[model samples]
Target chain A: MDDRPGAPRQNASEEIEALITLMAKLPGLGPRSARRAVLHLVKKRALLMTPLADAMHNVAASARECLVCGNISGAEVCHICRNEKRATGEICVVEDVADLWAMERAQVFGGRYHVLGGTLSALDSIGPEDLRIPKLVQRVADEGVSEVILALGATVDGQTTAHYIADALEGTGARLTSLAQGVPIGGELDYLDDGTITAALRARRSF
Target chain B: MDDRPGAPRQNASEEIEALITLMAKLPGLGPRSARRAVLHLVKKRALLMTPLADAMHNVAASARECLVCGNISGAEVCHICRNEKRATGEICVVEDVADLWAMERAQVFGGRYHVLGGTLSALDSIGPEDLRIPKLVQRVADEGVSEVILALGATVDGQTTAHYIADALEGTGARLTSLAQGVPIGGELDYLDDGTITAALRARRSF
Candidate 1:
């Protein structure tokens, strides 16, 4: 009778409660919404549901972080790192793999990617070691990367991280450039359309 | 160099590419957007990334469908259906379990629910068996039901399903009612805000 599942409980199955709890934890989905999503998935089991479950299961089982770029992968090296044709002298530096994928979808960037994971934030006490900065530097040297394109956020911390990376790679002989200032502050590259990303890449400025 | 992974024979370690591909398949996410999401999750590994991964893994392993009402439940039956207090001699019959959960969020519907799975769509060749209509009928008889409230969509298919059920239950002593006609055509109950749902429930009409 008590709507609260936390109450000394009734005859409910533990698995059902567990499923609801997990669905409730998802972004934009609360306990109520999670219940709805679960219901929808079950009813449409043949079309949308089964495929989604399989995808989730497969991804969950095989997913791992890329050692080189912190990108999601099924194996050790991410696809971007393994691809030979994508190994242009240019390496597009992004704060996240999502941005890298966005670039790839636009089909403009022929080069590889360096996912920084996140920008330096003093408030968050996040430093270079917390991200993939060290690996990025090593990649430039090990891969003969000629240019490091910075497609980071315009936030203060993002700018600060960019400057730090530029300083660290000063003698690496790789041309350091950044996406144009056109990217608004705290504006994630994910929200930008293909044209905007292209323009930003085309009008890159020297760091 | 070639960004495409599943396109041909190659090593399967392309984590970034795999992540991007998987992400691209998410609802409201394309190849480009999935890439961005993966990148962001990787960057915020500690704060956002790790937590999300753990959550996904947990849900992936345990999530399942409820046997009774067809809601997402970790166990055989959903929490709502198991609670004795929820057995208020009234059952709100909805086209989908999502509708049931939406009603729950309003904290107005104290009774149990019957998830029909979907409306009877002739064009789609969806019949009573195709949905959980038979199950709903069985539940009404088994649960000592008083009122069978229909919270179906305003679409033609939804109306057809409602009429079919009403006709089927015509001789039954239980009363048949439906949510007000104010609900828009082809409108999903999930998209409506709480107030609208409350109004619709309060202004319900006889079938």
Candidate 2:
């Protein structure tokens, strides 16, 4: 009974312990996994750990948020914003940089992106001014954007923010569209929630 | 579908791409998780990413394997090897540094450790010389050790290494013991493997 695998230990060196502590604060890693990861990193120093350290150092020194779209980049303007080929007069709005990256991975949207950082939260006292909403409005007018895609989440805050943006861009004369809600790919209708089923039913289309 | 998540994109900056590539190479992480982790790191650069980078740099610069027992530390001799209080006559031999760290977490073993790096693998052509077995033998003879506990796995390679160590230490006058095999706490007999069930039966105690 004394051999619990993940009990905290004070025997590790200060740097290793510190590294594990920081690593455990990451999104999916816990303390036990952090310990295992640190061990792996140290054992493969030449192949992985050192390179990762160098990469992080470089990023910490050079990485910046794009002044135009709020995407992260090494330059003031992100590559997507600077790329002339992607200047298709369309802007996709997302809540965070992770969502922007996810959209990029899909490669479905061939235009630029605007990261709002987070949605407006009344409880948190967040307003449109706190986000990049004003910048987005300005971008729509200045860039002659033809379409504005609101790819926000289905949460209350996300919807509230989407409606607020729609109102703000009312006079900008840009067409606005939000992603459709329904059963996801490979999802079974029987297992779907009532709300999704209703949305899917309402949004039914002809083949 | 043109929406493959991991299709290589030239949009990401070189350093960020490099970091994600290395992170994906970790034992428990994949491309998607690595991308998420990198995005998290970039967003929290001031608090988490900077500190993690510094800690990695420090550990990479100073961490060294213990000359005596193979434990990792900032010093030539690890803290466990240097600690006078833990100089018990017992030595626990393990397959890797992670296992050594796991034992330290248990805090029950008041003895030092010998990390074998890996178990014997005939298919991989791993002989005794590939491990720290020779150093362990020397330590047993020179340190006046009383017992050598084999805290290795019950896998074929683990058993093979344990038996090989035992044969090598036949005349070393140290008591040899392997970890006991039995039903684990909170385990069900129905779900237990045949080998484990047989071992548990053979080692059953009478009330």
Candidate 3:
């Protein structure tokens, strides 16, 4: 018997094993935790367990990704893409679907989003074509998008991707903006570098 | 036009609304977060979304409560109940199935579990019948269980339920043993009341 981390237990059903495998892949969870979680969901079938399972099934049957902006949807285009009111000549570009949703939860941005799936990573052999950069450029022209807000992370890859996108959209006459840096977010001001502080200070306008 | 939190936009579907409603009820999730989670799942259908949904549907269709111990199951009795190896002389009793699973994760005990479902609570109109006390007693005799280990919480209702079960099982030839109480379990021990401390001390024996 192999002693690998999260190895499948002997004599378990394929379905149960599959559940354990998938659950183990979830963030902050492992094989042991997955087993425990699956057991729990199975036990609370009427109240919590069933509903969660039903939700998973319904989503499985209907879920699809929006080809235009990389947002997940039940159809070819997501609800955000279908909404004419959201087409406000501005596109907020994000690094991941989760980040896009986080922005949506704030309810401050009235414009729609374009998910990049991930930032530029030379180490990972990821190039511009690997991301949704081409589609974003196509959207700028087709949708008459005026402003592109870069909501990438502060990481090197995130900055590189933001710059790459900024350069790509230069000919389209679309203004590029990014989320502010060097702010004491969640009370972690002490972690800021001098470069970040300097860049934030230089970028500071009237606001 | 209600001002309540998490009110969906007028264009959202009833199914989507229902999904959002149920998602909102989940632990660590609220209405706004639920909306975002649903959106993310729907979009990632082929990868992150569809499989999750499929798993949910399968579980939902087959899930049922174990008639014997109130554990979640896909049949008349749970896997624990069906397993012959688990029919040891000792039964580890718990306030809920979650607690039962916690003990299982620890893997110290080889005996079966008795899920009381919940603790005794006067504030919520809960009583012995509201729990699985009667079923537990019956099982002790029917299964020839020699020892009944009480692994309930140290809360007021938890202690009350434990004592109630101890009294009910008197002279049934089943030795009742509660989990130790000296340690600051579920919290630091200094926070416990003097009466609880005294009782725990009196109940203490040679390890």
Q: Which candidate leads in lDDT?
A: 2
| Top model number, TM-score | 2
lDDT of 2 by residue, A1-207 (tens): 332446555556889888988998887787777888999888887788888888888888788899999998989999999989889999999999888887887768899999999999999999999999999999999999999999999999999999999999998889999999999999999899999999999999997
Candidate 1, DockQ score (0 to 1):
0.18
Q: Evaluate residue A9 in candidate 2 and report its C-alpha lDDT on the 0 to 100 scale.
A: 53
- Of the candidates numbered 1 and 2, which has the greater lDDT value? 2
Comparing 1 and 3 by DockQ, which wins? 3
DockQ of each: 0.18, 0.54, 0.20
State which candidate, 2 or 3, has the greater TM-score. Answer: 2
Candidate ranking (lDDT, best to worst): 2, 3, 1
lDDT of 2 at B106: 66
Best by DockQ, which number?
2
Candidate 3 lDDT score relative to the true structure: 0.74
In terms of lDDT, the poorest run of 10 residues in model 3 chain A is: A1-10
Per residue, candidate 3 scores C-alpha lDDT tens digits across A35-136 of 666765555557875676566666566655687888766678888888999999999999877787667756678888999989889999999988999999
State the lDDT of candidate 1 residue by residue for A1-207, as single tens digits: 324655543322454445456545444455555555544444444555444444444555566777877666777777777888888899888887556655665567788788887899999999989988898889999989999999887778988999999998999999999876556667899998776688678878899
